[model samples]
Structures are given as structure tokens and as C-alpha cells.
Target chain A: MGLLAYGDTGWGDELFFATLMTIAVALVAIFIGFFLAAIFASFKLSSIRILNLFGSFYTTVFRGVPELLVIYLFFFGSSGAVMYVAKIFGYDGYIEVNAFFTGALSIGIISGAYSTEVFRGAVQSINKGQFEASKVLGLKKKVYYYKIIIPQMLRLALPNISNVWQITLKDTSLISVTGLVEIMRQSYIAAGSTRDPLFFYSFAAVLYLFLTFLSMKLFNNLEKHYSRGY
Target chain B: MELMIESFPRLLNATILTIELTLLSLFFGIFVGAFFAVLRTSKIKIFQVISYYYSYIFRGTPLLVQIFIIYFGLGQVEWLRESFLWVVFKEPYSCAIIAFTLNTGAYTSEIFRSAFETIQKGLIEAADGLGLNKLHIFFKIKLPLAIKQSLPAYGNEMILMLKGTSLASTVTLLDLTGVAKHIISTTFKPVEVFIVAGSIYLLMTFIIHNFIKILEKKLDYSK
Candidate 1:
């Protein structure tokens, strides 16, 4: 307990801040994931052969590879690319790609592959009659999608989106390898310094469990809210 | 390009270790999962509670943290270190297997539990009416139906386990990803090494996908 106190004598403050960092990174990554998912889902739903192939390729590659490898790729690959671009601009100094951006981006790419499946499923589950009814009503394509498709897709996808959220949150722990001082990394530091690996690691697990429990409750409420009148 | 070619055989060799890790843990995970899934559906209140919390804790946290806890945290316990169990906990490989087994077992339990729950009541009642004992009914009827129903989900779990085994590298196991990381450290070429390694993983995933599809077809009685 004293070991977790909130100052120099304890790692509580660091751990708390790291939890917040974990949430922040996960939130950013989920939005990026959702954005990429929309594009990929649309690509899969499109009639164009190349677009469909590209979408499948993206999901297959991302889903098959390990998330750790993806993070490592971004961590190593991003800095080199950044430095090369900087050098071209006559800035020869080392350009560091911060771990937060690398972590969020890598996780975003991985989660995007998953969310694409969810979104595609949601889109496919939309009855053909709805599309036919919209056509008969003479609504513009934009208005049809906005009023008829997107809202229903959101309702259908909410459960799985919550699942993706859980995975994204857990995946943030992997970002600790990129030197982000998230909960896992902070706990590692504390465990190393305190020579109490059991205590600190258990503390980290409890923090993760707390976050997941809270989000599960929140998602349950969201699902209930979205399912209203349906 | 040269580095990728040069590291390809080494990465391929390390992939054997990766396969071994995934298969071994999954083998043990199935039994653990089955036992817990039974407990989850059992009538006893305590058994259900125990199964629920076990899966809840394991599924809630990241596998990396679980690995750290088992590999590093457990080694810190004084009594356990003094005891014979130290032999298992002291080795990073065994620690990783234990961690992966428990982690996958929790997930597998949930899958199996739902599969078991969805087993048609009529089948069990028919078995009961046929004068089979409780054990016989469960082993012969409920288990087979659940296994058939759960095959697709379990196939996804297999791929997830394959991907999950990459984390064994963090525990000092020289798996495919570990060897790739080692190569990248020395040669300073992450893209090529990872591309090769990732391709191997993708190939394995493709193989698993087809294998499961074949199994699903073979098991489909209606077909």
C-alpha cells in the first residue's frame, strides 16, 4: 500500500498517469481504426475488383501478423522514414518518431483490420428490402446512406465495436515495448526498482481489469441505448 | 533483399519453435478449457463462480502482462522458489507455455461453455430416456454436439493462439518473431525480416483455415 503512495516514495502517481495515457492512446487508436474500417469496409462492399482485392489484402495481412511485430515495424520503420524525409529538407539531425504516435498508429492498423470485418458484417446484414425501399422513395444516394444505412449499421456494429474496443485497450499494453510509459511499462519500472515483481505486476493486472470492467459496463449501456425502438 | 534471403532459413527454423509453442499450449489449453467449461455449466454454485472469475481475470488482462507475472512475478515468491515447483517457473520456456495455456484456456472455456449451453435439450433428454448414465450422456452426446458447433470459433482461436505465441519472444524464447527481432537488431533491417516472418505466419494461417474448413465439412453429418 505504501509502495503505491502518490509521490517520490511511491509509484502510484506514475501508474495512474500511465493508466490515463493508456486510455488516451486507445481512444485515438480506436478512432483511427474506425476511420480505416469505414474505408476498407466500403472497399469490400464496392463492386470494383481492385478495390475489393485491396481490402481483402489489407485485412488478411494485418490480421495474420502479430501485433508485437506490427509495433516493432512501426517503431523502427517510422523513425527511418521520418529521418530520410527530414534529411531531404536539409535537416540532418536525428528525427525521433515518438512512441505514442508509433504505438497508436500500429494498434490502429491492427484494429482496423478487425473493425473492417465487423463493419462489413453489419453492412451485409442490412436487408436488401431497405435498399429497395430507399430507391423507391427517390432519396439521393448521400441522403439514403446517411439516413438509412449508417445509423442501422452503427446499431448492428455496436456489440462488435465494443469487442474491438476491449482488444484495442489490451493491445495498448504491447506499446510499452515502444518505450511508452503506459501502465505496463510503468509497472515494469516499478517492479524492477522495488524488487517486488509480484506486487507491481499484480497491481498492473488489477488496473487493467478495472479498465475492462468499466468499459464493459459502459458498452452494455451503449448497446441498450442503441437498441431502443429496434 | 539480401538480408531477407539470408535470414529466411533461420526464421523458418525458428518457426518450428513457434509451432511447437502454439500447439503444445493449445493441446493443454483444450483440457483446461473443457474442465472449466463443464464447471461453468455445472449446477454447483461454487463451481460456476470459480469458473467465471478464472475466465474473467485471464481474459481481462493482456497476455504480455500474464507472461510477465508468471515468468517474473512467480519467481519472486520465496516459498515457491524454495519448493520443487521452481523447476518449472525458473525456465522461461515453461513459464511462457504455462502463461499461454492459462490465457488460451480461459478464452477456450468461454467458447466451449457457450457451445455447451446451446446444445439442444432434446438430445440430452433422448440420451437420458435411452437409459444412459449421466456420464455417458455427457461424453457421447453433449460433448460431440458442442465440439461440432464450436469448430468454427475454435478455429479462429487456433489462429489467435498462433499469433499469441509470438509473445513468447518477450520471455526470452527464440521463436520465429524472436529470431526475426534478433536479425533486425544485428542487420538493422526490420522491414525485410518482418515481411518474411509475417509471410510465414500468414501461410500458417492459410493452412489452418483450410484444415479447419476440411474438418468442418467432414464432420457435417447433413452433408
Candidate 2:
């Protein structure tokens, strides 16, 4: 409809850009989750009791709490901590937590908890003999991980990673509470200003479904590509 | 820590609301989910198709969008406003319940369907051999076995639903997260307020987690 047209009067361009922002935030969070997941998964897999406890504790706290609370902590709560540190450094001013940073970080932490479980499961599923054979071949630790272990872990973890991606993508909607101009926020704004909630929300729903469908196809292809040999 | 104790009552009050919302919606979700699960696996093509699309649309989108559509979108319709449905959709609490019920129902239906499928064909055949009616067989055998088999997965779903109820706060419902945000706004102490609130949620979920573990063990023992 004309209401969704491009340029200033219409919200078409705004919606398109919001969709991109959603994808951008999700990708950033997903990458952050992958890094955190690696560390936590290692801690979980470690022999040390303290390390295992820390890993379990991290996942339990993050996974058990509501995602909204997590976001609120990062958005509103972090500013207090940030200000205290800034005051210590003698650069005290009203420091604000940016929407993108808060949104991505909170979701990233939540996603990392799930990713930790997924990666741990993948590591546990790998054959111990593979590690033994790699050592027998005189492969260094780095090469063992990269050449022998990482690929297999990736193949096994791909399906779960895809699930995490879907979760991360959908969770981006919650970031709208922080005033991020993502798809949900944009639709909300347009709906309010135009007084057409039904139209704008349906449009937003369609956009989300489109994103989900595309991601599903992409992950399916990745699964096929990674699982080529087995 | 001191602030957390002082604010405990407020947080506990909100926790009660959160628990109420979760239990009520989950109560509705289970029945709707079960019905849809049956429909999904039924011989009727139309029922299966309806079930398929219901799950597809609800599962594909985020609960936030669904909430918005129901609250903001549906609330806009003049006919809906004039109809008897207005009683349910007019208030934020009921709207939240409806959204949570439908969303959880979609996910739970899938869980139930998988659980039903896992019910061995031989058990159903044996029940049939005993000359049990379809309804009797489903009620006596398939339903119990499917639920028992699905208990662990259903526990995860319950946790998810508990967390999902936080979304109600966005719609102006004063649940746990909603109350926490309110306290933070008034007290200007986001960290303390949120810590208290988050801990309450963590505690509740921990209890549920352990409860489910005990249930799983008991079920395993009896089997």
C-alpha cells in the first residue's frame, strides 16, 4: 500500500533498514555467543571442579532468568556500573548505554549459554580415538584442533547452531524495549504514528517469517555442505 | 543486599503474578496443544492442514510479534471491540494470557505430537485387540504414555513458558520484570532492583528444575 511506500512520507525504507539492523544485531550476537560458548564449553569439559562449577553456574543463571531481565540489566543496570568506573577514572558524566550494544550483548550472553551446552555435547560426541590418532600422526595441538577436531565439531554442532541462530534472530525483537530501531520497534513506531496497528504489525510479521524462512534454507544448505563426507 | 531484602515483598508480589500468568496460560495451552496434536495426526486432511499452518505461523514468528498482533492489531478492529470477545481482549492481562496460551500451545502441540508418535504402535494395537473403543484407548493408554514419555521435554517447555511470561510486562502487565522495572524507575537503582528480581526468577526456575528431576526419577522407577 501507499503507506508502505519509500521515502519520507512512507515507511518502506525505514522498515527495510530496520530489517537489516535486526540481521546485523543478530549476526553480532551470534559471533559473540560462539566465542563465549567456546570458553564455557572448555570450562565444562575441564577436569577441574571449580572450572566445571563456574561453567555450570554461568549457564544456569543465564538460561534460567528471563531474557527481558537480562536485557534490562545490561541496558539500565550497566549504566550504574559504567558510571562508577568512569568516576574512578575521573571522567564522570552522564554516560548512556547505547541500544545496539546493550541489545546485542544481552542476547549474546543468553545465546552463549545454549551454545555452551550445544558445543559441549558436540565435543563429548566426538571419538576419543580421533585425538589419539592425531597425536600418533605427530600433529601439534593447534593442528589437532583445526584439522582433526574443529571440522567434526562443526558438522555435529551445525544443527544446534542453527537453532541458536533462530533463537537469536527472534530475540532481537525484545531489544526494541531499549529503543533500538529494529523491525519490531520500527513497526511499533509506524503503527503509532500512522494509527494503523493492524497493517503495520501484519507487515512486520510477514517480514519476520521471511527472515526465518531464508535462515532455515541457509542453515539447511550449510548442514548439507558440512556433512558432505558423512 | 540490604536493598534486596527491603524490596523483597514487591518482587515477591510480582513473582506471584508471573506464576499465575504462567500456570493459567500453560493450563490452557496443554488442552489446546493436545487437541491440535490429535488433529495434526488425524486422518482428516483439513484438520491436519489447519494444525500444520497453526504451528507454522505461531512457531515461525517471535512471541513479541504475536503479542503485538493480538494486542495492538486485534484491538484495533471495530467489530472485535463491539463483540463479546471484547471482554477478554479489552484488558492487558487477558490479552497476555491469550497470546501466551496460543504461542505455548503451538510449541506444546509439537511436543505432544512427537510424544504421541513415540507411543509404540503395538500398544495401540493391543488396546484395539482388547476391544477398547478409540476414545477409551486414547484416554487410557496413548494419552498417559505420551505424557509420561514427554515429561522431560515438557519440563523444558515449562521453563521456557515461565520465562516467556515476562513478555507480558511489555504489554503493561505488572509481572516480575514489570515490577522490577517499576522499582528501578522509582528508586533509580537498576542494579539492586534487577538483581533482586533476577534472583527470584532464578530461584523459581531452580525449584521447577529440581521438581522435574524428581518427577522424572519417580516416573522412571515406576516404569
Residue-wise lDDT of candidate 1 within B1-223, one digit each (tens)? 8888889999999999999999999999999999999899889999999999999999999999999999999999999999999999999999999999999999999999999889888888888899999989978888888889999999999999999999999988999988888887787678998899999999999999999999999889787
Candidate 2 lDDT, A66-128, residue by residue in tens: 998888878877778888899999987999878898899999999999999999999999999
Candidate 1 global lDDT: 0.94
Model 2 iRMSD vs. native: 1.0
List of clashing residue pairs for candidate 2: none
| Predicted model with the maximum lDDT | 1
Q: Where is the poorest 10-residue window by lDDT in model 1 chain B?
A: B181-190
Off by over 4 Å in 1: none
Backbone clashes (count) for model 2: 0
Q: What's the CA error at residue A21 for candidate 1, in Å?
A: 0.5
For chain B alone, what TM-score does every candidate structure achieve against the true structure?
A: 0.97, 0.94
- What is the RMSD, in Å, between candidate 1 and the native fold over all Cα? 1.2
- The ten-residue window of minimal lDDT in model 1 chain A covers A221-230
**How do all models score by TM-score?**
0.98, 0.97
